[model samples]
Target: MAKTKKLAFICYPGQETFIEPIVREYEKRPQYQVHRYYTDQQADVIAAVKWADILWLEWANQLTAVATQVYEIKSKSVIVRLHSYEALSSLPTRVNWKVVDYLVFVAPHIRDIVKMQIHDIEKQVCTKIIPNGLDIDNIPKNKVFNMYDIAYVCNLSLKKEPAMMLQIMAELVKFNPAFHLHSAGGWQDKGCEIYMKHMAKEMGIEENITYYGFVENMETFWPGKGILLSTSFHEGHPCNIMEGMARGLRPVIHNFIGAKGLYQEKYLFNTVVDAINMITEWSATTPDEKDYRKYVIDRGWTKKSMMASISKLIRLCGKKA
Candidate 1:
């Protein structure tokens, strides 16, 4: 019988959305003993690090920075996955890169940003780009396509650009008052929330927008929506865009950094006018729903593809340990 290796996934609480799926996959395999340590306690962090033969740190945040400084990790292989915020923040500067065997990046632009910020990152660790993936096979494709109905799913924050979203909605309502926006996700910034409410009423487009707060089950919520709109300043392989696309919803994403590399030109928009034109133009032609879903499949952005690559990397790291 093969020896069972200890694997620990460490991350801060409430940030385990991406790591949870990977942990479920490893639990089913016999050769791995999986443990998820979601805490910031110094003693607990050290215990988890010492117990595992391999560590998968979800974010290159404070938890990871502290974990890398542990003495026991010298004998254990480590993989740190940096999403987006860490690259822009000072957290990456504090992380000890020499101890990390594999540095996984969700997008190429994020990797490039981190390299520029942290000197000799490429030479210190083996960097890999693995875009965020969705479990496409299980996501039921019950799309209710309507050109007038737009869907927006994301936590409202300054970076999400809720103000820009309002501008788009205001323009859309002018084109046709029937144009409505259905928004999900909670507010992370109180100021943004206050501003969004005030601006929506001031702009006279409040009647055209409906807020559903934070939706727990998107499968049921997505059926009535037609178009998925993303107006973020930046993103690291946004799962919301992929989730909506998997459900056959046409996406109108902002031209954020690295937007063109991940999505087709037709799906991207730079300004409110550009977004208005894309929707108005698409409504005229009316492409098939299958095309949206096909884009995700062709790019190999399914959960199966993502897990396969991660699993191979895990095995390679384990062999080295």
Candidate 2:
């Protein structure tokens, strides 16, 4: 039998959604033994790091800073994955990048933001741009043909720009009162939640919008939704939009910073008027389900491709270790 390689994955509580799929894939392989440490417990974390030949820090947050700084990982290969929010925070500066053999960024813009903050990051660690991956085969493409039913899948936060979604819906209702917006995900910011709900009623879009708080089964929730909408001020390659696309929903993303770099102009809108026109145009045309799903596949945004890229990185790191 081939010798088994030990792997330790460290992240915070309730933030394992992105790493869980990769963990499961590693668990299934006979040549690997995976240990996922989601807690910030120092003793347990140190123990997990000592037990593994390779360590993967899921988010470049406080947990990663602590691990890379104090953990006795000189002999072990360390990989840090930075998503969007962490790049904006001060935690990336706190992390010891010299110890990190490989750093993975979900988007090029996200990497650039971090590079700006950490001037010598390029010389310290090897960084790779790997887009967030979706489990495409499992996300059933059972789209209910209702172009008027727009889907908004994101946590209610300041950066998400929730007000713009209401604006889009208000204009959409003007074109057709049948236009409805289905919003998923829990509220992350209380202030944003209060403001959004108050403005929804004030803007007369309350009746046209339904709040499905923190949907656990997106497979069932996505089938009836026709168009997936994103009105974010910025993003790091959102997984929700890709998931909706996998379900055959046409994506109507905002042309936020780096939006054009990650996605084609066809799916992006710069203003509320642009969004209204895009949705109305799609409603008038035939629904092309295959095209959306194909875009995801062509971009290598699936779980299998993600694992392959990470696995290749692991092998290279293993050789160096």
Candidate 3:
């Protein structure tokens, strides 16, 4: 029998939700043997790097001293997954870009921005654009469209612009009293928490807003909601938008990088007032739910689409069973 190829994934401790599911899916195949190591522990991380045929790291900030040690020890290819937060600022000079064989971006706009910032397009590094994918077969279908509720699933961070979402909901309440907003996801910084609480109270929309922090099953919270809103300043193909659309919820997103190609003019907004208008208009119109579901499934959220991309990436690394 042929030996299974060993693969090591190095990431921060709390990122298991994002990384684990993908790793688990890949490991199901008989050709691969996967091991996960948290970068928080230096010695264990280094040991895992030395033992694997491939190194996969998540987030630019999470790459610390341990990441450098991995590059030094491992002759295997290195792949870094870049998110929106990493592209917002400058990267450290000692990142050892030469060690990276491939850099994957979740959106094309993010890839463009990073290339402009680095200014070395001629470098030997390979860049791939792979948007976040959802398990469409598992997502429950919400047959009924309840116009009373709207939901936003993301971390309550400043860059996510939760304050703007609160303001939009505040204005929406006057026009439609039954309008309710549901929020889920964790808070990273103190400022984000304080701002979220202050805005909810100040806008007098606290009664209508339901906070379900850090949910494990977004499928339950996503369905039955009439419209989904994303007011982020930036994003690398947000999972929330994809998941919401899969559940037959219409999406109203700000004019950001990843959203440009996915939605139409009716769903795109440039400002708070624009967002309010767009949401209100979407809520009023009763579009065909089947059409919405079909759109999401066709655009890389289906099981087949995700597996094809993953297989392509694995093959690109020159690994064999």
Candidate number achieving the greatest TM-score relative to the actual structure: 1
- Which consecutive 10 residues in model 1 have the weakest lDDT in total? 280-289
lDDT of each: 0.89, 0.87, 0.76
> How would you encode candidate 1's per-residue C-alpha lDDT over 45-101 as one tens digit per residue?
899999999999999999999999999899999999999988889999999989999
- Ten-residue region with minimum lDDT total, candidate 2: 136-145
True-structure Cα RMSD, model 2: 1.3
Off by over 4 Å in 3: 68-74
Residue lDDT tens for model 3, 1-321: 977777788888876656677788878978778888865877777787778777777776545334755555447767777777777777623356666777777778887777767777327467787777777888866877876688888888878888788789889998897899888888867988887788788878889998898998766776678888888988887878877777888888888875777676677899989977777777777756677788887777665676677568876674621
Q: Write the per-residue lDDT of candidate 2 for residues 1-321, one digit (tens) a residue.
A: 656788889988899999988898889888778898999788777887789888999999988888887647877899999999998888899988888999999999998888788988888899998888887777778546688888999988989998999988988898899999999989999888898899989988899999999998876677777899999998998998888887888899999878888788999998899999999999977578888888899999998888889989988877765
Alpha-carbon RMSD to native, per candidate: 1.1, 1.3, 2.3
Q: What C-alpha lDDT does candidate 3 achieve relative to the native structure?
A: 0.76
Top lDDT prediction, candidate number? 1
> Which of candidates 1 and 2 is the stronger one according to lDDT?
1
After superposing candidate 2, which stretches have Cα over 4 Å from the reference?
Answer: none
Off by over 4 Å in 1: none
What does candidate 1 score on TM? 0.98
lDDT score at residue 84, model 2, on the 0-100 scale:
90
